[model samples]
Target: MSEAATLTRTAQKTEHFDVLIVGAGIAGVGGAYHMAKERPGSSFVVLDVQETFGGTWATHKYPGIRSDSDLYTFGYSFKPWVGAPIATAEEILRYMGEVIDDNDLARHIRYKHKITKASWSSQDNLWTLEAVRTDTGEELRFTTNFLWMCQGYFRHSKGYTPEWPGMADFKGKIVHPQTWPQDLDYKGKKVVVIGSGATAATLVPNIADDCAHVTLLQRSPTYFIPGRNANELADTLRELKIDETWIHEIVRRKIVHDGAAFARRAQEEPEAVTAELLAGVRAFLGDDFDVEKHFTPRYRPWRQRIAFIPGGDLFMGIASGKASVVTDEIDRFTEKGIALKSGETLEADIIVTATGFDLAVLGDIDFSIDGKTLDFGKTVTYRGMMFTGVPNMVWVFGYFRASWTLRADMVAEFVLRLLKHMDEKHVKKVEVALREQDDNMPLLPWIDPENFNPGYLMRGMHLLPKSGDKPEWRHSQDYLAEKEAFPLIDLDDKAFVYK
Candidate 1:
């Protein structure tokens, strides 16, 4: 067939839905479940680029991969996490499968559908999406009145790795944790894991047992707090023969409240919290470990995410001589290992770059309104869910300081309430347009640069939408504050415009 003919046929093959979701991860799954429960009659479909249902859990298969936050808050509010507080990737993936099966959401998800662009039309009162099949390379199109971006804020293709000096000169194998090879073996080999974030923390202890030795090389230290792998409260309830439902509720509430209160304390009294956190580390690692030289970070606690070490496994590995931590700058790659600026050399058979992710908002999908391209940086966020001048669209960005699912649940509730209100008013379109008075409100980055310490977020802050000083414009990172704000949010606020 001719190119023009194929294009015409592809355009004719467009499908339509009442609502369209752009991912099948935790956010997408919960958003779909909530949407269906709120508006039973509405037709919707979730389009995912990956072959599986679990987004990150399915993709990241590195050793010792697990949840950074406790599953009580990380897991959906509607679902009960009866397992350990921190869970493995396999366990979490299984939980996701259970959620999909229990909710009957499998029928609504279209896998291998990579969305490329989404355009909104004011005259037609709908959104047109262009997608491609990964296996076949065939084009597909879809249309919907409401677009929900549940794809989390990172690129799925690859993790962010810096270009080191003379990387190709190294003789050893170099691998990124994001795309860990299934068949690659590291047993009896010396492995050097780069970066000091959660991935590095998890990788060192996990591979330490199998490998001859593992070295965690980092330029700086991250705040880490030793925590139990299992939730004692949940375990006690189970031992007492309490019903799972009641136990789930009690444990979830307790974790949520405690997490919120602790975060507040960290932000309000960082020094006290920092001292308290370091004291626990000292207790575990002991006086001879040189905690100040190796573990102390320049930033205050909770400014950057506090890495949670379940059972103090990382420190235990270091103390046992199976693993070690080196805090110094990497000068370059040598034939067998990495060379440090301090004139020290470390040998390794394998190198794992546990660097981080490349933040990609809205799945890097090109968005346009009324045939005009939209610049996200130029626009402002509406309550951190919707963006100004964007109509019938919601972006699922969670709290950085707390469990990601906490804010995701709130966004689901707020979207459903907004949809219901729009239905009652018989509104054709709902846009979050900044009023004249809103222009005077000082606009700030979605996340203040000085406040958070995640690498990807800090690098992509310029690409994110702006926020104002007011409640309607600010994105609340506090889970407890949002619990109150989202429940009593004013739907009739001047920030939203209906037609």
Candidate 2:
């Protein structure tokens, strides 16, 4: 197909929804489950760009892809992962499929329905939407009263960026880790991965045995730390049978909240404790290697994403001569290989541009209210769940300090409470004021786009919280406080306008 032909064209309208949850990921499904449970009278539906549900799981099928965060805090509050603490990509996908099956959410979801735009009609308080089906190339349209977009940080499918000029000039076969084809064997191929985040770290060990040599290229360093959910915490919880969900949630909340506290403290004053931990990585790397330069980052420890150190697998890969790290800016690409700013060139049979994702804060949807564009840039996050001045919408973005599900779980609960309040009070719509009151408003650091080095739309930082701000502004990134703030019995207030 031609490149122009590959571009999505919007279709005409057909269906309607009381609530339309975009991107059928965990957040979208979780919100639907809550709505069904708390306010059964409310009509809802979810749509995914893919042919099936399980947004992240269904999309990213890379080799050795798994959660860097422990499974204890990653799974749902109502549903505890009964298998393992750390899970494989396939395992997580299976679990998500189970969530879809158990909740009977299949009928509510329309696969291959790629939503292109969501425009809110102020006069009617409804959003007219656009969609395209990949299989048929058919166009369609729909409408919804409210929208819950859980598209997460990445694009909806397997995307590798050839954004850098001269990418096509490279003589070597180029592959994006996100779009890793199962049939394209890397065995005995000299491969180079051009990225420095979690994906890069994880990809290193997975292809080591197959590749003749692999090089990880990075523009800047990320703070690296060891992580995993190796053991079976799930079996222990089941054996106890003490309200499995309750105990599971409690433990998840505890580990995430407390562990983040430790990480924060470790950052503010590494000498207080984790100095030895940093030293551990340095010692493992040895004196000849400049650990402080290649390993240590410029920002405070967790300011950016701390690379998940998988029990020294990456370091061991380097030490074993199977892999090497190259910190340099890419000047351009040549037919033979990639040339760096430092005038160094690396020859390779295959190249992997793990070069970050193209991020979409609100999933690239042109959202507008009453013909007035909902400039996401102009709004402050109200509790990180709802945006100020945006009406009848709830977005669930997780935490960098803790596991993604920790904040996601809280956001899900908060959405439920909001839905319940709407149901009880007979309120059809809810809107937040764009302006702030006094010094209470906070400009959080959670929305930093550079944290993950993902696609421009995939980075979920800068959307985070800051200290001393209201829970509306200050997302504590803590579990207990978030839980309390989320499940409020009476959410009606002057701040939250109801109609």
Candidate 3:
């Protein structure tokens, strides 16, 4: 029962699974769940870069960190969250753990085994993966007949380091929300929050009550509006004795379609909705606050992730003198405080960099496809899940604008379908045709952000999938439409070639 012996036994067995899943986040775990259900007795392992499961849930331990999306859509469907409409990170993480436990996936989960590189072998039609363990100098090399690249793309390991002028000089316990220090106390101390994204918004009100002075720095104005995003509707349906899965389906559809409808409106009449959104922020600020300077954003509505007052705590915090909002660019950092472009210096004891997250590509893991070094940037994403010509690989790059679970669920089903198809046809490898792909479309910012750096809110706009001629090729921000498009097992037969 020794550690090395256990590993040696595992290594000697070469425990061949039908699929090898990477990144034990929502997507990968969810996919594994579906695959387990559909194809019983099929061996698989869900691996993670971190020491624990729940990728962002486990790592992002920032104070006042909570989900932006309502828990109904955000929470897993199999498990019910009876806690509250809005959930804290701990609650969500607990929910995820429950999912793994309920499904008995804990044994299949291996953590801290970072997959550095994955290369597909054409001859064997399998993937050879290079994985390294952080704690011990242990190295693992493995191969699977099929590779499910539920490969996630968030820079979790490192914080987004903005090249702020003289930032290194004034550094007074500078912290990023992704890697918050629990020991640091902000009670009665001057705290400056620098950013306008959801993370900053969520933290401002939560921290304002404890801090002496809190200033929200905005280099560029963010689209701020007040709205309701609750799981109460889901709860009510459950009370009515409606089928829970049916309720999940309906709610998921509602959110997805609502996103699509809003996107359509933005495409049709950009200025009207944009002005209306700006007006909401203006209304929240009152007549005294400068709405034009602090609320107006450079891009139109839907171009950037809009900040919403889910609990109205942000505006309440500002009104209660607990928070202050500043719209100015950071000129540089002085020893005592930060200097803004308006020749103003704000004193601060602690600075929180809430700038935003960079769209990191799959742990920034290196890839070699058939001995060719894979340039992920040059490679166009196929259905936002599979990349063109990446044989035997199916990744889960879900929705950014809509619920994260929506596409993840569908991608799970898609993987199941493809796997079933392979088994039915007695095929080991299958390659989806690039010709079947619709490349003549705009790259959505909602998923791709290698280029979007300055504005964190707008980074995802380029990441959204292109509107294809057909639903299969299209990435619908709309939920119900996606349901019709991506059924459990209705992929285009001609699009895939069996080996």
Candidate 4:
């Protein structure tokens, strides 16, 4: 072959690593940090489809975008969050960037590498990944001993928007918050926002003053905790001259403890919890406003996530008459706006669909084991991290009720321990399988609908892996229980097979 041909072939050779982390988002970055810190000198690469880090924060550019959870818990344990409890997207990006730069993790990451396929070869005992450079359209190949899937659970290309009749006939521009257009002007425009979730809550308050008239339209209301963004404990600690790191740990523990208690109260004494939540809304909306009709949810609190609105901003917007709420199903879209089932028409110059996300199963990548396509739905989840019949792979599916990074940090620690155990035993492969005692364990859906049934999960539940009756086989979303249980798990359990 010609020297030029030889050079080209060499350039396209498959790169190999001890581990390949699939994403540069919060979970992915956390995993990478743990590997670098605990397993120093390990060969690992972090690949992301986006041009930079901060997965959700990087891609979402909608105005007033901020975290629904408090930063003390949402932030990593190793890092101290000195900002407000609720932080904006820019603040989050800056925090993540500091983690990368401070840890010198930038060298281990490759941007714009979108994995298209992941094939596990039991004979070779490695995962072969095929990816395409989204920016350049160049095919790339890599082989890794372990695959850490942390690409997140939503389709970033588009947000979920239910189709309504006469959408094509509408004269006004319809936009989804996931892909907000930068050039689109909304100044003095009469706007209508659909959906009552966190996105709507955040967007309505931010855009209320800019729009001529804004209306928040929802089919059913969702629960929210409207309060000041400050954390009193952390503020007190700061005033006492306590270190930021110490403050972070102290405040995180307090929040987690309080959150667990609140969750229990919601489940055990839902009526009281419901009354307390509505009262908070009444405080902002006053007795004259219809809080029961506008803010009361049909389901109990914590069935779906209860978003936290900093300083009750959304309620303030409504009370000021800058924004209004309409509780009714959409009959269809009208030329000028939306037609409601209550025989009312909301006129608008622009419409924003604040609907939920389209859940992505295993990053939506085509996965196969030994030349056979893998159906995640058929396999059982092992503690919601590892799956039966999948070798040398661990996915970071974080907690829904708590800060996502809490579980991400826990999973990272578990991964480090597992890797060390494998090394000490001189094993090349490891996978979780059901023990004999688990043979008759009933298989159930990923999550029980009664416990938590969000729209995205309900829509994509079929695509997720099944869980068993035992705690070893299910994802117990209870953070407090898992925090105590994870560290005590025996590495030599019969469920783990090594070779």
Q: Each model's TM-score, in the order given?
A: 0.97, 0.85, 0.88, 0.98
Stretches off by above 4 angstroms in model 1 are 1-8
CA shift of 472, model 3, Å: 5.2
lDDT of 3 by residue, 188-229 (tens): 988898888888888899888889989999887766667654
* Candidate lDDT values, in order: 0.89, 0.71, 0.73, 0.94
Best by lDDT: 4
lDDT of 4 by residue, 449-497 (tens): 9999999999999999999989989988899899999898898999999
Candidate that scores best on TM-score: 4
What's the lDDT of the predicted structure labeled candidate 4?
Answer: 0.94
lDDT, residue 204, candidate 3: 90
- In terms of lDDT, model 2 sits at 0.71
Tens-place lDDT per residue, model 2, 122-187, is: 678778888888789878788887788787866655464656768889887888777778787789
Error of 1 at 194 (Å): 0.8
TM-score of 3: 0.88
- Model 1: per-residue lDDT, tens digit, 1-499? 9999988887789899888988999899998898778888999999999998788998898988998988888898888888888899999989988988887888999999999999999999999999999999998899998998899988989999999997999998999999999887999999999998898999899999999999999898899989778888899999999988888889988988887788878889988998888887888789998888788888887888877899999999998999999999999999999999999998999999998999998889999999999898888998888998898999999888788888888899888888888899998799888888876889898977777768888899889999998877888777777788787877777778898
* Structure candidate 4, residue pairs in collision: none
Worst 10-residue lDDT window for candidate 1 reads 447-456
